[model samples]
Target: MLILKLTNITKEYNSRVILNDINLSCKNCEMIAIKGKSGVGKSTLLNIMAGLERATSGEYYYNEILMNDKSINSLSKFRQANVGYISQHSPMIPELTVLENICVPVWFEKDEEKKKEYMQQIESLSMLFEINNLLDKKINALSGGEIQRAGIIRSILKKPQLIIADEPTAALDDETALMILTHFNFLKSEGAIIIVVTHNDIVSKHCDKTYQLSKEGLLLIS
Candidate 1:
């Protein structure tokens, strides 16, 4: 099934075009890597899909529903419930404990039983990410890699249908980057649509397919 579709999408800043007539679609269980040089609008594309940024032209569809300005509230709810985003820098609260941070999104669910179920899932994900030890630790006390793993755990804890990552491995060393990418691969196998915006060649090589962004537009690189 098509999980996301972007048709003739364009983004401009002060009349300067960043993305031009880009079209793409992602299927369920697909792992797509978006690669390009610095400042090539890779992150812009991901942000637009995630509803963090608005497209200047064209349309974005998630699960066959058109996403537009009037659907802002619906988009926000969909993102919080069905999409998980991991940016270059992990957005962890300095004062919150790792477990607390992971469970923060759970409060959005009003169902008491479902909220408790999600908390249990979070604990399992923390263990899977090897972050169980850090659950009680404040975010500020974690090392770079620890925080990054926590971020991944937090994203997956919600069992999102789509996972969008922007240079998620940029702060990690070679081995750690490979490990994180491997985890993403595993998630893809379990039926999540994973889209990663990365400049890393290793990540591109491991992805199911790759797209490159340039001044002209988005092109298939692999």
Candidate 2:
């Protein structure tokens, strides 16, 4: 079953076109990678998927519903509930401690029992990523890799249906990148659709499918 489908997707800035006539379909338990040079529209594509930006032309369907026609408010709600985005840089709040930053996803979770359950899950994942020791430290006190790890933990904490990550492992070492990618696989097994934009081979190689993005569109590379 298709969780996401895009056809004839295009994005343009001024007179320059970044993406042209791109088509993609992703399903449950699938992990896809978008790879390209630094200036390519890899991030743009991921942002489109995450509903952070709109395409210039095309159709976008999420769970068989036409999302392109959705109102701004509807899109925002849908994103908050179904999309987990990890951008190239850490989006953590400098004033928030590592644990607090990681808890952002569950901030509005209403049920007390479910809130505790999610907190425990976050703790387990923090330990798995070896970030548990830094939980009480301010975000600014953490290293680049540590901040990136925290960003990752926040993204998956809600276990959203779609995970759209942009260069998620760019700041991590090879061992740590592999550890994070392995966790993505575990999320996939639970029926999440993972899509990441990256230039790193470690990330591309770990995905079930990899595509190279260009001005012409997205071309399958693996």
Candidate 3:
């Protein structure tokens, strides 16, 4: 099964140690939560997991491949092929329609088969997030919760093996947040690994496992 393992992962900036000797592991079809107080480097750790940043020391393995020493280009390719990220605000281009922003990543697929798959995913995910009707609206016209739902569809459009979400339901109300969590469980059942970094108890309580991040490292608190 798809496996992600981090061993002795460490990060430093200038002279500050953000993550120190952290270790974590996750397998397919699992939804995990990472919780921590502000300034505890939760986002930094997510960056490393999403390949947006590299750990200064230690190894990161996906399945059986070692990613610690891969070139920047290779890492970029890896992210494109295997990682999906849902950010706090669900970054979108203000000028683009929700549909356009969601399709930006796979708008020009060379493979007809792949294109069809993405199209189907968009349709299905839009329904799941209940955002199909908002597709025609410009990003600037949508509310925070609506934008967050659209962002979720965009992030998973490619069906990446690893899904990295940072406070995905922060802007959503309780109902919408539960809807998001339900879909996360659905994704897990479909064999995708979901890593969520959130401080929301409702969100954390829904995950299969929970870990707390600190300067000391990552620890399983539940």
Candidate 4:
């Protein structure tokens, strides 16, 4: 079983401490929700968890493997292999078509077999997220909700073990949000570890565990 363990994780910006001695532990198949007011370092915590940012003074371990000490290149490899990150806004190239943008993550896959599987997954996920019809549209042409769905498809198409999302449903209507979360449920059942930072209670309701982050750190909420 894959396990994610953060031990005494702390983040500092200049002299300010963003995350203070935070600790968390979980394994695959668990969906976790982190709720907090804006500007409480929620995104910072998510970045640290996703290996996009290094913790100032702590240990981050995935299945007993140390991640804090890895070099930039090693960290990049780690993220490429294990992470599916959904940023709050679109991270796609404005000039690219939605389908091309969605295929960005696996554009370098040299294996012919994996390429076929990736194409199959792209088709399924695009249809599942209701963005197949918009595939030819440029990123700059799509609405916020459409871009959000496309972003979701791109992050998850690689079948990552860690799904880190920052306000994933902010731009979508409730129905569309439910559609995406329902798919997240399927991913969870398949042993993916999902972590979402959201202010919406509707998002929390779908998770197995919920926590509120404060200046002090993570606090469990029921």
* Model 2 stretches with alpha carbons more than 4 Å out: none
TM-score of each: 0.94, 0.95, 0.96, 0.97
Candidate 3: RMSD over Cα atoms? 1.1
Clashing pairs in 2: none
What local lDDT score does residue 19 receive in model 3, on the 0 to 100 scale? 89
Best by TM-score: 4
Candidate 3 lDDT over 96-142, as tens digits, reads: 99998999888767898998899899998998888898899988888
The candidates, ranked best first by lDDT, are 4, 3, 2, 1
How well is each residue in 104-186 modelled by candidate 4, as lDDT tens digits?
Answer: 97788999899889889999999988889999988888888889999898899889999999999988898888998999999
Q: Tell me the TM-score of model 4.
A: 0.97
Give the Å shift of residue 6 in candidate 2: 0.6
Model 3: CA > 4 A from native: none
* Model 4 worst lDDT window (10 residues): 87-96
Q: What does candidate 3 score on TM? A: 0.96
**Local distance difference test scores for all models:** 0.85, 0.88, 0.90, 0.90
> Model 2, poorest ten-residue lDDT window?
87-96
lDDT for each residue of candidate 1 in 20-65, tens digit (9 for 90 to 100): 9999998888999998888878888888988778899998888898
lDDT of 2 by residue, 1-222 (tens): 757999999889996888899999999999999888888888888888888888888998899998887888888898988998988687878998999989987888898998988898898999999999999999989989888988888888878889998888887788889989999999999999999988788788889999888777889979
Candidate 3 yields a Cα-based lDDT of: 0.90
RMSD in angstroms, all models?
Answer: 1.5, 1.4, 1.1, 1.0
Write down the TM-score for model 2.
0.95
